[model samples]
Target: MNAPPDIATEAADHVRIVLVGTQHPGNIGSAARALKTMGLRRLVLVAPQKFPHADADAMAAGADDVLASALRVDTLAEAVADCRLVLGCTARSRRVQLRELRPRDAAAMAHAEAVAGGEVALVFGRERTGLDNAELQLCHAAVHIPANPDYSSLNLAAAVQVLSYELRLALLGAGGEMPVHAAALPAGAVPHAALEGFFAQLADTLEAIDFHKGRAPASAMRKLRRLFVRTGLDEKEIRLLRGILADAQRMARLARDAGRA
Candidate 1:
């Protein structure tokens, strides 16, 4: 007799494991195996150097179904565009200013978002370099695995396995209830794509209004991103913010026209 589907299993459906810029086909297969062992199935690959290879198949062992159904995308943005909650797995914090979460805490967040009907993604980076600053910027938070300081290096598959195990434990511990104090994404929270769109529009509006004031915009934009991402802006808030930007842009255009006259 099969076990009944529970909240954890259903929530797992909304969670995806994303691998970005993977260099090894074997790692992909191994990651798939790890995910399957923990009852996770969704896998998204972003710009893997080698995939659909014999070594990947061999490493996946009996988890061929996972490899077969894995999604391949050209960029990290595409992999997690629809996700409301995206957590990047990093060995260490980078220049990007993101809230850091331990694997267990990250798993709780993922479960909370999934339970709240939001898509969640746990992202891993390349084997050698890990996720770059630009890639890290796409993530809502960073998930750091605390290994021994003397030798903190972790294999790509191993990192995936760690996170997968944590997520599985979180799911099992929930016992069909949402994890307490897990900071669930609000039901109205916008998808990553929407937030990205708003950011682009905001940049354009800032330029229109000369917000940078003859200075470089990268630093300011980064700060702005950090501020907004931490707030977990929802659809209504995003719309409101974008509307304000539009007005600012219009006023800037009018000012420029009047000055010309």
Candidate 2:
């Protein structure tokens, strides 16, 4: 009968997003801004078209922190790894039997799951086509925004705003302590610049190995960056990954030296 709260009931009630195959950087940026407005800090990007763009940051404006702290992964499987309940967004009803909810109902369900100490997630598909069967199977439920059936093509960011607004309402209503900005993050989160450098190095390595399924190197780099951005990696995780990268580089150098001999 009543609306959902605006902010998280507790820190654990975080309303995280998993954007799968997003094609636009601006949409990602706008979505980040929307999440920030609703006080939801966690984001998980999965195989986006482009990321770590000046455009995304520029669009985020005051929500730059969200852009800086996003978590990215190449696959939806990895993005939802920690989530106990994954809800995918759909614009159309399906012929197959599946659990689906309107945006309000989905928000209410996700909030209850969060309060129960469950790791919940909301998954969004590409701007053009929604999730394929492979992607949807990963979700326990699907959410459909109740728009006019005559015109159902909602822009990706608009859909994000709709869901985020409902969550903000729900969290603000349930009543909770003030936000914990400083202590909430895992200790020693990676700074933005360092992560950018890591992306460059990672891109170089991936290019050498041709790991992007025939996508051009430039396009691959963009996708990889989106994936990394959503991980929300801390300093320790970054350092560990960088060390791995360094080792690979070292091995390649040794091979080159021996070949030169």
Candidate 3:
């Protein structure tokens, strides 16, 4: 059993580049380039003003892979559900009492947290409004790209690049293996076996109540696979969950025996 993505052991790969409600096409393009320069590939755009080969592609330069692989979603919740850790990139101070730091400091903190346990994510909001309080609440902390506090608003892509660059440096300088904060991450993605087992049990339970109809098990399982992958769970958390499920089965058996006796 491995540990889950906790406040620690989560690193750069776990970091996700999210653009919430972006307005300009060029910003999107530049952001993609920023991510590529930093060795980050995960990009999520929540209801951008425009996509599908905007001027962003031109700005992306040779790093179009970031744009090509961009995950476009209808909502912010959809973008971060499976993420183990969430961070907001903000220029202004947060109203609520959440941790906030300059970009360099925030990057270092996020990097340190990743070194400890699970995957981490740094989210950037739209161009004008930035991350609203509601959006910021989803984050464990807020990251600020230090600028002239007199005028510290950075473009969305610039923010992305700054943080990404920090993470890249942290990863390269990382000596040997990152300290194992949790059970070994379940080898990149969740094992098919685990997902299959969950599906089998879920399908059986659904059938017991006669719910499932035409949903293909394998196809249906794809959604679950994405769900698990998004969370970036380490082996330990998965085992704990399985253990709880197994105990429920054991209890059911005991109840059945008692009823018969």
Report the Cα RMSD per candidate.
Answer: 2.7, 11.9, 11.0
lDDT of 3 at 203: 47
How do the residues 1-261 of candidate 2 rate in per-residue lDDT, one tens digit apiece? 333433244633455888888888988899989888777878889988899887888778788888888888898877776665577888654532346676766666666656656577888999888888667655656788988878878988889889888766655554233234311322113433455568778876665444666876655554455455435566688888988988887777777788899
lDDT value, residue 119 of candidate 2? 70
Ranking by lDDT: 1, 2, 3
lDDT of 3 by residue, 155-232 (tens): 777778888876665555542334343222222233334434554565454444334476555444444544554465
Q: What would you estimate as the lDDT of candidate 3?
A: 0.65
Candidate 1: tens digits of C-alpha lDDT, residues 175-203: 24444444643321789999999999999
TM-score to true structure, per model: 0.93, 0.62, 0.61
Tell me, by lDDT, which candidate is best: 1
